[model samples]
Target: MNVAAIETVPLFEYLEFEFLLEYDVFAPCDRGRTRVHEPPELFQGFLHCYYEDVYGTRPVTRELQKPLVWFSCGFDRPPSRDAVDRFLTDLEHVVDDVFDHLVE
Candidate 1:
């Protein structure tokens, strides 16, 4: 049987940080809730994972921790898996719109 293959694109090639920052969907932290990472940054990370075809907080977190990934994304260091997970959870209510916006 012949094997099929797909090409891989370099991470962040067409995905500029400024582009992700253009979307202002993330809501401000509620009175009792506190966020360790900035909303835009986390959302950018979320989108980065999407474009790179990476899924889940664990893999995303790992991908983000690559030596220069954080610096390139404007973070001093990558956020923990827990932080990524929390960011994902927090966006559950509005994530569909966010994805729709990306499509458009």
Candidate 2:
């Protein structure tokens, strides 16, 4: 995902309160059933996610416009690599998207 695109959303909306959760999508995987890997800071800012759902109408599919409240405010702590991988793996939904139109 593009970092500049992620920064377009207003971060202040998420600064002191909770953001609303909207929709989700299942993403595609590698031949070995590998999962998407994202850096900790990737989860820190406004970003879009792509999910390739092998079981859905199509593969490498995506959901968009969902919002998430990052827990990094307390500390500069990032989610463990394993946890991040797992989250990406199980991301059968979109927390948000700034690119594509989000369809349920």
Candidate 3:
């Protein structure tokens, strides 16, 4: 994820405070010795990526927003290195396109 993009807006602006707090509290315990690590900042980027993937340019209606929040909070399991690598590699392109749309 691009630091410049991330710094432009606070992550909590997009995510609920309770959700971020819960993850901050539990992530260490839940991810006991996982080789594929995701920092909180990177995870925020993933959430944004997933959100854009699902919602496209449409306004995030309440019905559509709930599932994205649920999915982001519930996806706590550690993925395999191969899976993480693959997803992140693909995510770069997705994020680029998302940013392109945002700029336009």
lDDT digits (tens) for residues 27-103 of candidate 1? 45556566567766676666666767899878999987964555555566789888888778867866676667656
Worst 10 residues of 3 by lDDT: 55-64
Native-referenced Cα lDDT, model 1: 0.63
Q: How far out, in Å, is residue 94 in model 3?
A: 2.4
| Candidate 1 colliding pairs | none
Which of candidates 1 and 3 is the stronger one according to TM-score? 1
- After superposition, which runs of candidate 3 have C-alpha atoms over 4 Å from their true positions? 1-74, 101-104
> Model 3 lDDT vs. the true structure?
0.40
| Model 3 Cα lDDT, one tens digit per residue, 1-104 | 34333331455455432333233322444547543434443345345545455332232222223433424433344334453444355445455544554356
Report the Cα lDDT for residue 104, model 3: 64
State the C-alpha lDDT per candidate.
0.63, 0.31, 0.40
Candidate 2 per-residue lDDT, tens place, 1-104, comes to: 33234332455334422212222222334455532333223333223232112232122111221222222212143334454444544443444451233232
Estimated TM-score for each candidate = 0.62, 0.27, 0.29
User: Top model by TM-score, which number?
Assistant: 1
> Sorted on lDDT, highest at the top, how do the candidates line up?
1, 3, 2
